[model samples]
Target: MTASTPGGRRVRIALQLQPQHAEYRQIRDTVLRAEDLGVDVIFNWDHFFPLHGDPDGKHFECWTMLGAWAEQTERVEIGALVTCNSYRNPELLADMARTVDHMSGGRLILGIGAGWFQKDYDQFGYEFGTPGRRIARLAADLPRIRARLAAGNPAPTRDIPILVGGGGERKTLRVVAEHADIWHSFSDLETLRRKSAILDEHGAAIGRDTARAVERSVAPHGEPEQAGEALVAAGATLLAIGVSGPDHDLTRLARWIAWRDAQG
Candidate 1:
């Protein structure tokens, strides 16, 4: 597929409603509101435990939440900010994603990664292999996932956009170049620039259109006007602002929404 212009492409904003320390009802309510407030995407993290706050805080599984979101929201793409690829079989994950894609009428994005949280590994009994090994597994599994998605009974509503989240200069980026429709990272400007160039180099090995093929994605910092412009200049157009649960404040998200609306 041909790539779209990086900076010139439509700017999109995503909200990562970290599924921790909140009731499922509360999270569901917030998901509904975020969509009405005009977010382009709504994401949850793929972790078995809370990433911060209470170590044993209330947390929900990622894909299940996405499945629910697929039914609940009429608009807004739903996915994990990045799903940990270590947890489920690539074929199973592919089937799950395809099911949700159909459920949402094609509003699904399969965000995935080589997982890093050791607690999820330890408690869930998944091996806490070295980072390189985990990345290698991710690279190896992606093709299987693609094949499974293709082979599934009832094809997906559309080619599901696989979003890969990582910054490793070698393995991770290479995987991103090969499979990711969107490449995500939590990098500052310099890091975004540097690692993006590295991704381009890797993409070149596969004839990836660094400027057009893979969309750049990142978190927002500071004011939306300033942060959004800076990230876009650095080649990131997806501004995903993360928020915690319980209150699940939308102050930042609202501001970003206004910022995105103001862009038009």
Candidate 2:
């Protein structure tokens, strides 16, 4: 979903409610607070086990929680940081996205990526293939996902924006230039500058309009203003901050929201 903008530049704030060691009530409330604070998007991770410190800590599934978020929150887009392609069939995942999009009045961002967590693959009995193989699968399935979404009954109210999250200089970014409406990555200022240049190169190679075709997003770890300055200078307009569930930190979110406002 696109955000309200000013000065002809798009600025969006996203908070990832990482389901590391959190209860359902905590997760639900975080979503509520995100909307209350005027965050543009609220996200959760798609994993069976905890991603932070504990492998066996409290957690939840991705799509189910998205369904709940769709019902619970009155506004604010919802999605996974990047749903692992190994978890479900591509068509089914597309249908799941459509369902959530409808449930949320089209406030859904379909963030997807090539699966990487070996532990998730091992514990869930999914084949943990080589990195090349995973990207190949992701590349192949992206079209199927779009086709399914188009064919599904009660289609999404809007073309649910597909977000491809990764910074791989080769295949991943190329796929981003081809398929994603939103491209998400993690890097410092210099790295983001270099990589954005490379992404433009790739988009040129593919004859895609990189400048206006895709929205650039980054994951910010520290103070939002500092991070936001670096990333925006590097051509990023969407900034995402992660807050683990059960202990959702609105402190950082509030700061980022303020920073986003201060930019105007």
Candidate 3:
């Protein structure tokens, strides 16, 4: 949809095509179908195992899948739902993202978050540090990530967009204020509003106007015309719907896509 916020930003639709409990072929087909349907962005989660469905079900790693998507899809922007800062060294992650950005002809968004998922950590041999420690690590890594992106042998295809996912009022939002080009969450309208306000406060504290710099993103709960409209009114320019494995039915996704077209 092309409706702009008071700040003059248009609404955008994103699909989080979760990479779990499905074969790689199914996942790849889903990405192609979503792009064909005119989704503005496509995303896959960063996980070593299923977050839902059978515990040990089929799944794919995040970055590799994103690399594949970069080669496979053409119209839509792509990225991990939120790459775990704890999984790879920050510098290496930047290099990887830059490569994918080039592969996609400059359509990559680097969605990232402080690490979670105990199983991903346990299975990969990464320490399941306390939540505070993980956030601390993310805070320390953001600067290095930016630096690496700039210093890479060949820079990213463009100034890659940074999408920071998480709604922590303290560290996470503060970091978003400082570095994020997009701020993503699964929060409902009221919480989205509250956290956005807190994000502005942090931005002000840091002497930056985050309200303009960071686009607010939320996953609407109910009908798009209702819940999604509320979110847009509450300052979310990006509406993301999450679809997972197996069938990866897009009936609901079609409805949201229709709504976006209508708004335009």
Candidate 4:
């Protein structure tokens, strides 16, 4: 689905601040730089251990970092790329999202997904269910999250944009058609084109115009001009690039920001 905001174009830029092995100061500085560079959104992963290597490496909590970003950034929207459902109760997560939304002055995009990564579940003592079961839970919890957001004591200043990540053709895309404002995927160009077609089919089945229900997004990992042009042509409204580590690279991010500006 393609996202729109009163305008017809679907083009936005986001940067994922992957907290694999970085100190808090570095992560904070990277976020500031992303904001300064005029990126649209900023994100961090929601895993206890490092997803790349060294399971016992340094990492910070997702919501906490979001809170810090809320105070630190003035323009860029911030949230997890996809917060795991298994980590917290759905209602509580909604409350947290609402709080962050208000904290960021209605700039928080609540990105969530079915839980994956067994290391997180095993180490944290949360249940690690089968894929089908996990997706089922995610499907069920989305409405509850929406309900809780509405029922919260102080509702979010604005309706928080929901970003659902994953590319499961059967269940995930259908869920994206049904719930997500932005659908994020990690597929290459050919794969993204195929999956986007499938998502369009799913949206048609549900009577929701996929083109209006959600925005296509992906993580591009190369030169900004080339990657950005390719992804935009492939129906990706939001192009995300991940920056990892102790020394966060803002060079590529600046380049992408310049590209986005050029497109404008």
lDDT of 1 by residue, 1-264 (tens): 111234567778899999999999999999988999999999999998898899899999999889899999998999998999999999999999999999999999999999999999999999999999999999999999999999988999999999999999988999998989999987888899999999999978888786688999999778876777677778887879898979999988999888777765
lDDT per residue for candidate 2 within 100-124, as digits (tens), equals 9999998999999997889999988
Candidate 1 structure lDDT? 0.89
Q: Which residues of candidate 2, in runs, are more than 4 Å off? A: 1-7
> Model 4, stretches more than 4 Å misplaced?
1-7
For each candidate in turn, the TM-score is: 0.96, 0.95, 0.98, 0.95
Q: How would you encode candidate 3's per-residue C-alpha lDDT over 152-248 as one tens digit per residue?
A: 8787878999999998899899989999999997687889899999999999999999888899998889888777667777889888899988999
Count of backbone clashes, every candidate in sequence: 1, 0, 0, 2
lDDT value, residue 54 of candidate 3: 93
Q: What is the C-alpha local distance difference test score of each model?
A: 0.89, 0.86, 0.89, 0.87
What residue pairs are clashing in model 1?
3-212
Measured with C-alpha atoms, the lDDT of residue 184 in candidate 3 is 95
Given candidate 3, what's the lDDT at residue 75?
Answer: 88
Clashing pairs in 4: 1-210, 1-214
